[model samples]
Target: MTKHKCFLGLAILATLVATPAQAEEVSRKAADLMAQNSNSTDSVDQNSNNTQPPNTPLSPSLPSEPLYGGSDTASKLPASNYWYVSGSVGSASPGNDVQGSSIFNNKLNFALDSTSSWNIAGGYQRGNYRSELEISYSSFDVNNASIDTQSFPFSGNVSTTSILGNTYWDIPTGSKFRPYLGVGIGAGILSGKIKYQGQEADLGTGSSFAYQGKVGLEYELARKGNAFVEFKYLGIGKYQNDAGRDVTPPNSYGVNVGYRLGF
Candidate 1:
């Protein structure tokens, strides 16, 4: 036992006095000597050394990016692409020698009065041109009626409803106000009542070929609204009503004030 103790003491002193290079070499040798006593501790150390940083792996290409913004393309589109609707109210000025029916050519020499009128229309526009369909109504009360320029005839009311397809060319002044001229051709229906010699007669109803010409100007009010004034000339064909009351109203003229909405 005394001899074993002296040997162990000498080995420890040698290790402590050695240089770093020599120490590592000597430690390897000493670990071999300590293996019998330190095997259990070495097992724990191996478990700790097993933990390490993870390695990154290669991946596929990234996906494409997406586009942005609103889907309401119509709102951003040009003015030419807009569709619009309009309405108007105005006066119907009558013409002379309103004839009716194939019967007596019962020519009516009536002194007609200007009266109230209204119209509605819808259209599509592009550049400086527009195309539209319109329906208009007007009527007047007669103060006197004659047959063939003689003062012996029926007197009462005359009314007409017209539907027309129209197109216009806008004259731009580089301002908010736009002026235009247009023409239309379509059909009109006429009907009303009159009295002759204390006997009342139904003016009846008739459909005739019709045509018109118009001039107008529009003032922009809002982004989608406009106010306008228009003047128009109307020519209607002769036709008799259901009551055999032959009548053709004279060509008439009118002036109108209107509003329009667009999208």
Candidate 2:
């Protein structure tokens, strides 16, 4: 009985020792499994972070193209077919003569008295010179200085008609203004009797040669025409009397405002 009891005790001791060893082995295996699972989770998280792409901003679209539309017609106009008329109201005065040999200096006095005159003219422009033809009419009051038998003072009226050919050399300054110098030669008819010292002097109807020189400025009012204001010195040569006496002719000068058209 004693031996059997001893054998049972030994069996119980072996059972306790084997149970502790198996439990220890089970705990080590579970700890290794947990460490491996944690390492696998860390690898998965690192791969996910490394493989992520950077964000990109969206770009705006380009603007649309501009449309173009129109016609072309600006260089087709005629420029040189124009005509003009001119009128002026001004005075006529004589010049100074120191030597006193100027017969028409102060010997004859003419009063325009702000009278108005008209001229019809046409022009053809070529390069920088304009050629013109003019027909004009003017009137003046003439006073003769020579006394009569009683030595009384007198004055008379005269009407002069002229037809002239003129040429002007133009100096163009810019787009709007041009200053010019011009000359003209013409034939004129002088009429009406003169009163010398209150007596009628028989100055017959006669034809006289006439000339004009001018300097003026013109402003372009149209595409091919200009409005002008000018100062002119006009000369009418001497006349012949009935007894072949060389009588004094009309020597006048005045300011003229006029227009010129191009052709």
Candidate 3:
């Protein structure tokens, strides 16, 4: 009976010791599982922050090349070619020694008086060059005449109308003023009347080749307008009068003032 009692006591002691050891092992395993779960959650949060979108830019980008061939400012410059119209009025002085033949077959010479002249023109201007079509008119009075060296006061007048094609070269002065040289070739019609020693005569209308030369100074008044003063020389070929006499028209010199407008 005593041995059985002892055995029962030993069994009770062994169960108590094994129960505490198993409880310690279970507590350690629970701590390892909690630590693993916390590490996994932290890794997921780090990945989300790295994958977020990047920041936006502050300004737009610009182009590298120019819009035109020459330079950036070339496309904004004004035009160099244009069309223009002009008009002028001036005084004309004819050459003194105008020679012709009288109906009585006598050699005659005339001295002409200063007269008024006018012109209108339309043209195209390209940079320093210009081309134009012009119409002009003038009238001269005879101051005196000589029949083979015997001089006499004369009463007569001659008028001319001309159409010309003209060209000019403008010199650049880097200012508002420009100097120009011009030449023209064309046709003229001459017509008039004469009364000498109480004998009335008609100098019949006739057409002849004509030419002119010019030198001028131009002042710019605005972007599309200018004023000018010029000196001109005009000449015409010979033609016949009503009396069937060949008449040589005199060459003329003129000083003109004018204005030009551009389109």
Candidate 4:
């Protein structure tokens, strides 16, 4: 009985110690598994924060691309074929010193007033220089003249047409305001009639030599348009009338406002 009791006590102690050890081992394993799960979850969150979001708007990312959608890549103006056109309207005033001679060999002087004028031009440009073809028109009435007591104080309507070839030099200062100098030469067609003291004379349509010079400033109004103001001096040589007399037109000075279109 004593030996059996002793064996029982030893068995019970062994069972108690083994139970606690197994419990400790199981707790340790559980803790390790929890740490691994926590680390895995933290790593997943960190990777998600570092990742970029989807569907962000990056531009159609080249300079040549259209802003919206197109396969065509030309988004800027073409380099070649820099052609342009212009239209202008302004005032034309005559000079005081133009004179002509009648069939009687008498000196006939004229005084003219300011008149309305307009022009249209088209051209191509290269390297700051441009060549243009222009057409212009103006009309005026002469109020006073001096040929004699009977032929003085003339009354008349004069219409002029000009077809000109022009060249321009644009001073490139890389600014929105462009300053330029221009010169033009062509033929003028003059036609009108004059009356002095109940005597009327017809000035037939005749071609005259013409020339002009200009100074202008342009403002960039848009990508393809410009507004400008210009000062011009235009001269026309004498033309002969059907009566074998001369019709001398006065030199003209003009101030103009204009718009230009480029293509």
Candidate 5:
């Protein structure tokens, strides 16, 4: 019976010790589970904060290049060329002597103001300098009697045509306007018919050298084109007869208006 009682005591002691050990093991496991859950939640929160939108990317920014200043971007702008047509009235003047009847000899003088005549022309130009080739035609009659002869009208018709080549240097003075000066050299053909004693006589007919000097202002009408007003002193030098006789020629001062098509 004592042996049995000893065995019972030992068995009861062992049961109590085992129960405490099992409870401690369960507590340690619970703590480890809580730690693992805490680590998982922190990872989820960090991932949500660190993410980027679908459209955004990681890269460095770049700078833009300027258009003005020494950059060639401004130089790439278009170039311009110009063309035009103009018209005006002008007068002829006495240049040299003619030989014929006493009243008809070397007698031509400047056309009367009433003898003003009309002309037409066309031209072309490029950049700051321009060149033009033109053809002009005019016909007018003048009656000038020597102060000595208060009696009769020195009546006749003088017709002239010219082909000229002109060049200009255009100076820019404003954003919308420019001033220009030019010179022209040309050849002129003059034909004179005199009505004397009810008979028509051809006095002088030939080609002569001519020239002009001009000044003008041009106002831009389009971004690449302009309108201009010009004043010129034109000299159509002396005409000579087929027989080498010199006759009156044309010299006139006039103003003209025209357009230029810029390049």
Candidate 6:
């Protein structure tokens, strides 16, 4: 009976010890499960943060094209308009066929000689065109004279001055040398004195309408200057002197050389 009682007491003590160990193992397993759940939740939160969208900008980016449809090369082109002035000197050949009425009511005719001519001008130029105001002067020597088909030895000098408005057009050749044509209309004054048989008569001074035509070739000397040579024809209208004598001046041909300058 004592042995049986001792065996029962040992069995009860073993049961108590086993109960505490089982409780400790259950607590440890619960802690491990909670830690695993917390790690999984943290991993999910980190992945959500990494996958979020970025912040937007305040304005859009600019385009790569140029503004206002303009190109870089077009801004570098030369100017197309400017102002200029010019002068020329030349030789003139007067026509021999000059006619007039003498005081004696006789038909008079004159033969003339060549002379020197000169001019100065100022103007504006645009593109291939030009317009100018010109003042010119020329002179002639009388070779001989005749009254009613009767010839005589005559010695005299005739001089003329003109003011003209001229326009010119330059032809494009895509070279430094350019060709041009011109026309002018204006007024002129003519004056002369003649001697025959020791008697001198004043042909007097007169004013008339005048006109001219020109053709020329220009050579570029620099950006601001050009040299030119030209041929021209000038004609003066009929003139009536103070003495009541009617006179018609002859046509004149000329060759000129000149320079033109620009600003």
For every candidate in turn, the CA RMSD to the true structure comes to: 11.9, 18.6, 12.7, 9.7, 11.5, 13.6
Off by over 4 Å in 6: 1-80
All candidates' lDDT scores? 0.77, 0.60, 0.81, 0.77, 0.63, 0.81
The full ranking of all candidates by TM-score, starting with the best, is 6, 3, 4, 1, 5, 2
Q: Write the per-residue lDDT of candidate 2 for residues 1-263, one digit (tens) a residue.
A: 45445545655555577687775665565556666766888999998888645564366568865432111122222233244444444455433110111233333333322334566777666655778787766666644333222222456666667788999887855345778899999987766555754578554566679888889888767665578888877677666645454545555666777766553
Error of 3 at 17 (Å): 28
Q: Residue 238 lDDT in model 1?
A: 82
For residues 14-131, write the lDDT of model 6, one tens digit per residue: 5577687775665565556666766888999998888645685667688765332211222222222567789999999986567888777898887889989999998887767889
> How high is each candidate's TM-score?
0.65, 0.56, 0.69, 0.66, 0.59, 0.69
Model 5: colliding residue pairs: 79-263, 80-263, 81-262, 81-263, 82-261
Q: Lowest-scoring 10 consecutive residues by lDDT in candidate 4?
A: 68-77
The window of 10 residues in a row where model 3 has the poorest summed lDDT is 70-79
Error of 1 at 20 (Å): 47
* Residue pairs with backbone overlap in model 3: none
Per-model clash counts, in order, read 4, 0, 0, 0, 5, 0
Model 2: lDDT equals: 0.60
- Candidate 4 clashes: the total is 0
Error of 3 at 100 (Å): 1.3
Per-residue lDDT over 1-263 for candidate 1, one digit per residue giving the tens place of the 0 to 100 score: 45445546656766799877786676566656566546767888988997754564456568865432222133322245468999999998886645554255656566677889999999977667889999999887777776665776457888889999999987866655889999999999887777777887676789889999999998767655679999999889887677656567667899999998888
Query: What residue pairs clash in candidate 2, if any at all?
Result: none
Model 1: colliding residue pairs: 99-247, 99-248, 100-246, 100-247
lDDT of 1 at 158: 80
Better of 5 and 6 by TM-score: 6
Tell how far residue 132 is off in model 1, in angstroms: 0.9
